[model samples]
Target: MGDTPTTIWPLDDARPGEVVVIARWSPSAGKSETIAALLPELIQQSRAESGCLGYQAYRPDGADNGDLVLVERYADQSALDAHRNSVHFRTLVLERIVPLLADRHAVVTTVQ
Candidate 1:
């Protein structure tokens, strides 16, 4: 029997795959639901974008509502940037959705 050699891919090799963005949007008093209502369109439009791996919007269950959390995954930096510059993002999210928020925070990272 012949022996086979093992192959190892570097950790950084996986980094070229995608970028993840985690964000929280806390709308002003009485506006969370309004913003929440708009999320479906935002998510749908974003999903239709090129290089969009995953995009989601989440809100508190029941009456303990607080902030809206959005988790987004893109194929790379260029894809993420494209999403940000898209008409949907520019109009729906940046112009309309953002104004409803009292606070917003996000973190972006590269992922496999």
Candidate 2:
């Protein structure tokens, strides 16, 4: 009998797959508007990526929690990696937005 190797979708050797990332960002006091203002440019730049399937951001309804939710889809892990390495992500997100955020949370999943 031949032995079959076990493999994980993303952690193992998967290629040309689908990935989804959901992120929540809570802005620091008085910084919600600043983050909101930057979202348009962020969306524009992100959507222009070759491997980006979808990019959307939302503000929770009822009361101002100053939290922004982002749902992003990519063609594969490489695409997601590219997104994180992009100039806009580095400058706008890591540099500008991260400093203004009180907290941030994210989850990454691969489509089966």
Candidate 3:
């Protein structure tokens, strides 16, 4: 398997401290297992990071589409940036996740 290209998007006019990353994958070749396998590690890493307040992953109810949502809160933009650069995040995304996703989209957003 090889690394697949992933897109990262910053959500609608969000401020500096909070973020929500939405991930979408192809339906027939879903990424549920991959996300499940990686989520624990990702959560742990996020929690341990300097700026992470909370991080969670979810699958929308009644939705057959291969979509996953990650809700993340940080102390500030610096924390979120730190998460992006963290070893765990890098490893999870590049080594574990990229190979499994047929298509991926990430949107970073903040709460009002």
Candidate 4:
């Protein structure tokens, strides 16, 4: 395992009605395409959810851990919860995604 980048966003200084979710995923079986294919569905589901503020994905340059990051913001905790419980999330994780990932990390926080 490599040293994964630690990303901490200060919600205390964030704007009102903002929530944050950060995630990192590493590919298994040398297959990044599987992860990439699933992203659009994830983003669409997240963006369509009520109270979504913003959602984006990123890949770090020159990272050894095959790091892929997802950054998402919502209007509040309830919205974040809805995102977590969304069908698209469930389907992707259970049906299409988990088997392809070597590692995963996530942090969800509310803006103070």
Candidate 5:
């Protein structure tokens, strides 16, 4: 399959051929184990989506405890929207995982 390009309004800095989402999550007090347990399933299901080009979760070496970084690539804006509205995203991320997080930050970008 080939890459699909996308554009974001206003700022308009995104390049063509895929949208990338970078997110950081910090688990709430004593909720680290729970968040970790949810990662594998989340990653697996997300990667299985047709619009998802890639889905990966990371923990920085020497970084603060219970911090997770997720890097995801999708075909385009529609693909990303579909992912955000997907059943797995709603259930596993918004409901199960988000409730255990102290904070979460995400940014959308594209290849230069």
Candidate 6:
């Protein structure tokens, strides 16, 4: 499969045919480890999705942290939506991660 060009929204500025999603997560007090253990599988699954160009998970640099930042890119809106509605999203993200999270925020942007 051909790779789609990817760029950081704040840097390269997004363009059409690209969809960017930024997700910030704050795991519940004392639950960072639990959440951390689960993210690898989730990230792997997400990166394997069709139209996915990039999927990265980040946390604070210095120490074991309670926060996570997810940066994702898809070929288009439909791909992002498909990801949102995927079973993993419903079961793992919504059911599991959502409860462990103290708060979560997501923002979507289109490059163009």
Candidate 6 lDDT over residue span 72-93, tens digit each: 8898999999999998878889
C-alpha TM-score for every candidate: 0.80, 0.83, 0.68, 0.78, 0.83, 0.82
Model 3, span 1-112: residue lDDT tens: 1113352332434565475555554423656666667778777877888777666666665756656666667767677788888888788877787777666677766665
Tens-digit lDDT track of model 2 for 1-112: 0013342222233234689888899999999999989888998899899998878787656638789888888888999999999999999999999999999999998877
- Candidate 3 lDDT score at position 52: 75
TM-score of 2: 0.83
Candidate 5 accuracy as TM-score: 0.83
The number of clashing residue pairs in each candidate reads: 0, 0, 1, 0, 1, 5
Error of 4 at 87 (Å): 0.7
lDDT agreement with native, every candidate = 0.77, 0.82, 0.64, 0.75, 0.81, 0.80
Off by over 4 Å in 2: 1-16
Question: What pairs collide in candidate 6?
Answer: 14-111, 14-112, 15-111, 15-112, 16-111
Q: Model 5: per-residue lDDT, tens digit, 1-112?
A: 1123342222244347788998999999999889888888998898899988877777766857778888888888899999999999999999999999999999998665
After superposition, the stretches of candidate 1 with alpha carbons farther than 4 Å from their true spots are 1-16, 60-63
Candidate 2, which ten residues in sequence have the lowest lDDT sum?
A: 1-10
Alpha-carbon RMSD of each model? 10.9, 11.4, 8.6, 5.7, 7.8, 5.3
- Local accuracy of candidate 1 as per-residue lDDT tens digits, 1-112: 0013353322223456689888888888888777877788888899899888778666534535568767788888999999999999999988998898889999988874
**What C-alpha lDDT does candidate 4 achieve relative to the native structure?**
0.75
What clash pairs does model 5 have? 5-17
Which residue pairs in model 3 clash with each other?
A: 11-108
Q: What order do you get sorting by lDDT, best first?
A: 2, 5, 6, 1, 4, 3
| lDDT for each residue of candidate 4 in 1-112, tens digit (9 for 90 to 100) | 1124564442334676588988888889667877787788778777888888777777877866557887788888888878778888788865677788888898887666
